[model samples]
Target: MDILLSICAFILAILGIAGCIVPVLPGTLLSYGGLLCSYFASYSQMSTSALWIWLAVCIAVSLADYFLPAWMTRRFGGSRAGSIGATIGIFVGFFAGPVGIILGPFVGAVIGELVNDRSDFAKALVVGFGSFLSFFVGTGIKLIVAVGILVHVVADIWVHVVADIWPAFWNWLTNLF
Candidate 1:
């Protein structure tokens, strides 16, 4: 049971890391899930306080991810069209790979702004840039939280599993020599 939980935790941690840039996945929440799995494992040394703290951070980051893009768009004078376009771009970009993912929101925002107000190319560009910046900021924060959770899970595994087994494995190796 412990091993199974540990494996699940590792898989979740990896997925959480990928989710940070993928946009469709809830990276921080997935990471928090991983931490929870690890916490439940008998070998885990994680404290209840740490789990609660991580849960708070995950929720906060998730909320920020949802709102940051819209806030940035509005801050840069973008409208609902721009935000909608950015969202569409994210889904569309998913098929185009990394470069597309990176540029999709900006292009979408620009196109949306242009569609909304063709007379103001400069404003559209500003809105597009704002959306682009928001992507980076949001992704950066999510990545940080996800990575932190991964680190914690890994440390727990190392301390409990690897460290415990290392001495025995070393002895076996020495006897075989």
Candidate 2:
């Protein structure tokens, strides 16, 4: 039962990493869930207080993930339409590869600006650049947070699991010899 729970936690952690890149998944939150699973599976390893702290961190990161892109777009002089387009592009680009993912927001922003104001190519380009920068920035933040959670998971496993087993295994081997 412990092993199964551990496996489930590991899978969720992996999915969290993937979520960081995918945009559709709640990367940090899923990673947080993995942490929760690990705690429940091995209650001796981590305290409830520790789990609560991690939960707060995860929630903060998730909330930031939602706002950062839009905030950045506005900071870069992108209009509301540009922000909306970038959002739509993100979902659409998910179907495409990495290249599409990067370009989708940019193209969408430009087109959105163009549609909103047909006479201003320069403005459209500027808005598109802002939208593109926002996407990358958001992606970077999510990646960092997700990776941090995964690292925590690994460290917990090492401390609570391997540390417990290594000595026992060594003792068994010595006795056998």
- Give the per-residue lDDT digits (tens) of candidate 2, residues 35-147: 87787775447777877887887787777766665566566677787777777777787788887888888887777777788888898888888878877777787788778
Please list all clashing residue pairs in model 1, or write none if there are none: none
Which lDDT value does model 2 have at 7?
Answer: 62
Model 1 lDDT per residue over 1-177, tens place: 776777789889989999999877888888888899999988778899999999999999988887887678888999999888877776787788998889888888888888889999999999999989998999999999999999999998876657655566678899999
Choose the strongest candidate by TM-score.
Answer: 1
> To one decimal, what is the Cα RMSD in angstroms of model 1 from the true structure?
3.1
For candidate 2, what is the TM-score? 0.81
> Which portions of model 1 show Cα errors greater than 4 Å?
164-177
Question: lDDT scores for all predictions?
Answer: 0.86, 0.76
* Best model number under lDDT: 1
Error of 1 at 59 (Å): 1.7
